[model samples]
Target chain A: MKLWHSFLKEMKLSARGFYFYVEILVAVIILVMILFVVPENFRSVEDEYLFYDWPEGVFEEFVLPTLMEDDLDGKIESVEVEGDDILYPAQLIESEGTRYYIFESEEAVLRLTDLDRPKIGAIIRMDEQSQPYYEYYLQGYETQRLRNVYSIFHILDFDLMEAEFESQEVRSLTDGYLELSDRENIVPAMLTFNGSMMGVFIIAAYIFLDKQSGIIKAYAITASSVWQYLMSKVLVVLVSTILSTVIIVVPIMRLQPNYGILFVLLLASGLFSSTLGLVVASFYRNMMQAFGILYFLMIGLMLPAIAYFTPSWNPAWVQWIPTYPLIQAFKETILVNGDIGYVAWVSLGFFIASGILFVFANARYKKTLVS
Target chain B: MIKVSNLYHSYNKDEHYAVKDVSFEVEEGEIFGFLGPSGAGKSTTQNIMTGLLQLQKGNVTVAGYDVKTISNKMFNQIGMSFEESNVYSKLSAKENLEFYRKLFDVETRDPMELLRLVGLHDKADIRAGEFSKGMKHRLTFARSMINNPTLWFLDEPTTGLDPAIASEIKGIIREQNKKGVTIFLTTHNMYIADELCDRVAFIVDGELLLIDSPRNLKLQYGDKLVEVEYIKEGETIKESFSTIQKEDLDKLQEVIGKYEIQTMHTKEATLEEIFIKVTGRELV
Candidate 1:
């Protein structure tokens, strides 16, 4: 009952201070951006590749037929150009909203890619077998998925090979996982970044504010134990983060995402973040003394987002970051077909870490109250 | 109700101490004042006694609970009013009291009644952040009484309050004392200590100099003197004579017989003067 009142008091404080409203506003803004601003699908770059063949007829044989077979022939066009149109080369020429770019030579291809765009260039030559063996030039920043699509599109043969293709079977390792659109893929990132980490910032600021106003000193002589104070704050932040996650998820994802696992994952993440805030805030006297270190920790927490967006850049060290597994778990639950085993393991790890940190933070706070 | 023996607190855990070898006691239902200058270890001793500061090298107990082993149950029997206003600024006055009242396991006073005692009954709905400093102080004082504590610890409760509010607070303290509440008041205000304390301890430089009732201290340290103002040869003359000195008394009689006496009055030392005489330092 005492814990419940403490939680209610914290809720009242957050509501009256506008911290709760600000979080809701942030969730709503993210929802609006995801719903309207971000595109549903990033158009596949199959025809966006710029090609230059030595014999100059490889486009007609390999590319044109593939475009024609895919019923995307109207989207591609060949153009011949000379003069200063050569000086300022466009990666993709637009004519009536159609992609039409001419590759004059390997020099022109290099010039087009020199503008720092991710364009794939193919150099076709005749092998000793009298068949074409191609040398491909690629901008280093292209995603693994984009590179795979480029290889699959350009490797099609005149010999249909329908029998070989029919022999291949696709299967998923997880039971309920579904393919996520580009728009849906960002839901987990938003949830982990905005929803879970919000408490890390709020709790620290709240602690500093309480310290400045001498509220903790007043509370020290009260009958409430330090554990009650710490748990009440963590629970409040957990509720807030769950509310934000629901606001962002239900509008766009509806029932497709696993709400149970998602909420558990967020509860663990919010607990970890709030405890971290408590521990860090205990070291400083007020917000001004803590501002720099707080921002530095926030930026450190954000490092995992880089590995989230670029799956190919996964380093062994990044997996050690607490939020890395949290992001992965959120993605798993939000994408619905995510590996339950991985999510469960990550959630367990967070719960254990949060427990340890919470104990340490409680000790630190006890010392802080006296000082 | 409160006891301290060989209490020693060091900020750096070194030989240098903030509170050194302090010892005192407050009997049940008595108002004991701790009088000292700033940084004289008054707050440090009070903190240790109330379990705010850890018992580093001391034996202290409040209401039968050792400071080293104090529990939440012990806190239910204690109330503390800090020198500074520390109520939650975002919470209304009533809400602040209500929230604090929930922390106690024992029966508590009504929030409205406590607010009324502090003269903040009408502003109960207003947020504490919007209150003046005196109002916030009063609110803090009201919060301390919410638990109906048996052993009350008040630290400069009326330091920033106006005379009217300060008197009201003193009245509440006296009323609580009348109901068998033992108060440990720490303050540098000599007037309040003199008016309210059954006995006040004089401490300076982390050392206790003396502990006695205000009247006893005055009688012991004060010079029982009388000043006489008289007109002699058209020049106003003023002289002070020790009433206990026979020679001065004879001179006083001679002056009364030889000159036109303008005025005469007895002069007694105040508690502030006694504190200075005891500690050789001002209570700044």
Candidate 2:
């Protein structure tokens, strides 16, 4: 009951400050940006196709008709056919009785080109040895697009003309497409970067304000223990983080992640952040010094964000960061409904880290009070 | 209610003690003043007694519990108003008092009633941060009385208050003392100590110089003299003589027979003078 009273007092004091309203406003703004602005700004890149030196009637009879038949008109914005001159940016070009498709941009260009396969009634005039070049280009767009192109080729008996082709290739390509098309990876990454990182500043400010106001000393003389006081602060920050996470996740992603697991993960992250704040606030007597260290710590904690937005640049060492497992666990639960063994392990690591930090902070709190 | 013997404290190892072997006692229902200048270990000794600081080298007890082993239950019976106003600046006067009232298990005095006693009932809803220095001091005083503690520790209780408010606070202190509250006051203001304290301890450089009733200290340190003012030959003349000897009475009679005496008064030293005479240093 004393702990409850102390928690309520802490919450009431925090609510009266401007930082509380600013935090809520920031959460609402982030949700608003995610819902109303991000999609409009993140429009998918348009698919462009260039047909070089093709017959004038080929577009109308073959490419355009194939695109219409496949219901891909909206996917392929425009298919331009240029005569003899190779001035246009064409991925595929025909010259000297050879229908050749050149791979551009350091990789095979398969998804955006109209030359996925010749029309059903088109003549199979290309040499059989040119299949290697097609196979090389086929690797770029994953297996699903390859299968669709191959199925079109099969309709014209092009696969029969080439003995290297087999049905197993289609199955492998379908599997590859499933791997690349998973959209759930982005949600957890967003939650990790946006939801958990916010607790650092909120909890730090709470601790610093109380210390500055000398209220923490008052708590020391009261019936409440240091554990109860610190836990009350951690709980308040956890609730605020959860509220902000909900505001960002519910309307923006419409994702029904296993909330129980998500809440646990968020609480662990919040506790770690809160304990870290307590340690810093206890160590530094003023905000300027605490914020200086906080910025450095924030840079380290938010390193996982780089991995979230840009996966190619992610380094192996980033996995050692505390928030890394949190991000991975969130991705697993929200995307695949995977087992929580990793989450449990990372949660344990967080608990141990927070416990050590709490011990240190409590010692510092006592020392500061005495001084 | 409070006792200390050979109390010693220092902030650093083997350094000069901030409170060096300070010893004093306060009887129940007595207003005991710890008088010292800045850096005189007045606050250090008070903090040690209030359980805010650990006793380093001596025995100190408040309300029968050793200061080192004092618990929250003991803290409940001892209220402290620090030299610095430590009230929550963001909270209103009533809110600050009410918050502290709920911290103890005992039924506390009403927050409004305490505020009224401190003459702050009109500003009950104003945030304490917005209050002037004197008002903040009064609020702190009111906060100390919230628990109706038997042992009250007030450091510079009327430091920044106006004369009227200071008088009112002194009255409240006396009233609490009448109810058997032993107030442990620490201040450099000799006037306040002389007025309210039943007994005051003079300390300097963390050492006790003297401990006695203010009246007794004044009598011991002040000159036992009487002054007479008279008009002789249409001119005023002043004469002073030591009252402790018989010859002084003869001198007084001769002056009265020789001229018409206009005024006569006994000269008693102020507490500040006694403090300076005893310590050979100014209170500042």
Give the winner by lDDT: 1
Candidate 1 chain B least-lDDT 10 residues: B46-55
Assess candidate 1 and give its TM-score to the true structure. 0.88
Cα displacement (angstroms), candidate 2, residue A120, comes to: 34
- Alpha-carbon TM-score of each model against the true structure: 0.88, 0.79
lDDT of 1 by residue, A1-371 (tens): 88899999998898888777788899999999999998887665443335545455666677555544444334444454343365534334443323435465666666655553545556556767767666667778777986787678657863566767877898877665677889998887898878988788878888888888988888888999988988888887888898898899999999888788887788889888889888888898887888898898878877888998887788999888888888888888877566777888888888898999999998888665756
As a whole number from 0 to 100, the lDDT of residue A133 in candidate 2 is 19
Give candidate 1 regions above 4 Å deviation.
A44-100, A103-167, A174-176, B233-235, B256-261
On DockQ, the candidate that comes out on top is: 1
Please give the lDDT score at residue B137 for candidate 1: 92
Docking quality (DockQ) of candidate 2: 0.31
Q: How far out, in Å, is residue A347 in model 2? A: 2.7
Instruction: Tell me the docking grade of candidate 2.
Output: acceptable
